[model samples]
Target: MRSERPFSVFVDEFDAFASPAFATFLNKGRSSDFMIHLAHQTLSDLNRVSPDFMGQIMGNMNVRYIFRQDSQPDLGKPAKTR
Candidate 1:
């Protein structure tokens, strides 16, 4: 069943938030009516601030879109993050 009132969260420039609790919303916000969207420049931005969070961050996101200036990486393979 889907809710008529859908909820969404969009976080732009995601690397600015350094707190662990802020990231936890990605995990906890998954109600049937909720959607989460995150945007950032690069994966390195995340790795620099919190190396441990990559696993947690990737776990919650079922859909991923990667865009680069020169060329897009081959995203044919499935993500294998724990």
Candidate 2:
């Protein structure tokens, strides 16, 4: 159910916030790991019971997908002299 167009647009729009949010969610709070673990467990349980449960959960959560793009120019193009 992945869409390249939406992922690309999301990454382009939210790349800046992604890293910060990930870092904060991973390291800033003592319960972050627990929250992630709980989410995984719930998803696993729901998946086992109903294949479409995860999609429903994500849709309810308003979750979005993103993809990283290499936007840098080729080095062979030559660097501007400072």
Candidate 3:
């Protein structure tokens, strides 16, 4: 059973708010009609949180939209960060 009205959560500067528990929810929330929209300036934002955080997000997200950036690294390729 599910609610007729779906629920949605949008977080700006998601890197500041990311957590392992939340990342887990991203995988399980779909069945309950939960939707999440996250925004961040760069992948580095994720790297600052955890080494594998970026991969966790990119893997779960259904769609991605990248805006114009000063340095556009090849998103298809993995890049190391300090």
Candidate 4:
């Protein structure tokens, strides 16, 4: 069965953390498809969120690979490190 509690929490937190453009992008998609799309987009651009928050989101999703700098040289090095 689906858990509304976690999903609700996710929506609230997402709205708080995501940019207006990113949120708009997510809302335009189908609900069933949005999470998958969001996950993909988020993985592709982890810098969109704070590292601590990103870690929390990934942990909640049990995500293994949220796109890495090693995978995409175009993203450049970690901002904080520079």
Candidate 5:
């Protein structure tokens, strides 16, 4: 099944539901008029799948927003050094 008009899909808790096919769609969806919005709590959630897949997801994302998070690593902060 497919839509004739452009469409969008919102996937929340993306890491819990992501698959190799999603990686493919992220790479190819734009031209096909498909937009996918993925939301997750942390990169660690995606990393649990595979670092390579996580990299794929991050690389394909054109926009990202980081809300308040407790972990410094999630905010791309370097760990404190003495």
Candidate 6:
């Protein structure tokens, strides 16, 4: 089933699939109705899928989210941080 609103798809360990279908979907169907979210542990994971594919995949992503693994996440926060 599908919807008019964009649905977010989170793919964990992106290299495991190694399916070109994903590349085609993200490339040709880059619209609001469907969106793909990809995550990988390391650069090697993506490399395993093919460098060219990786580049094209990365380019398809409009937003980038990053996280930090510090000892204490709130340690350096200033007054009344959420």
In candidate 6, what are the lDDT values of residues 1-82, reduced to their tens digit? 4576777778887778756677887776665477778776544455566756656666677775546424353334222222
Best by TM-score: 3
lDDT, residue 45, candidate 1:
62
**What clash pairs does model 1 have?**
none
lDDT of 6: 0.62
Question: Clashing pairs in model 6?
Answer: none
Better of 3 and 5 by TM-score: 3
* Candidate 6: regions farther than 4 A off: 68-82
- Candidate 2 lDDT for residue 42: 24
Model 2 pairs whose backbones collide? none
Query: Could you give candidate 2's per-residue lDDT for residues 1-82 as a string of tens digits?
Result: 3333321111222222333234344343233223222123122333443555433434333232223323353221112211
**Evaluation by lDDT, superior candidate among 4 and 6:** 6
The alpha-carbon deviation from the true structure for residue 78 of candidate 2, after best TM-score superposition, in angstroms, is 40
The CA lDDT of each predicted structure is 0.68, 0.31, 0.75, 0.40, 0.75, 0.62
What is the alpha-carbon lDDT for the whole of candidate 3?
Answer: 0.75
lDDT, model 3, position 20: 79
Query: TM-scores of the models, in the given order?
Result: 0.71, 0.24, 0.77, 0.29, 0.76, 0.64
User: Could you tell me the TM-score of candidate 3?
Assistant: 0.77
Off by over 4 Å in 2: 1-42, 63-82
The TM-score ranking, best first, is 3, 5, 1, 6, 4, 2
Evaluated at residue 19, the lDDT of candidate 4 is 56
Q: Which tens-of-lDDT digit does each residue in 1-82 have in candidate 4?
A: 3334323223433434565455444444334333422333334354455444444334334223435445464343333221
Angstrom error at residue 70, model 3 = 2.7
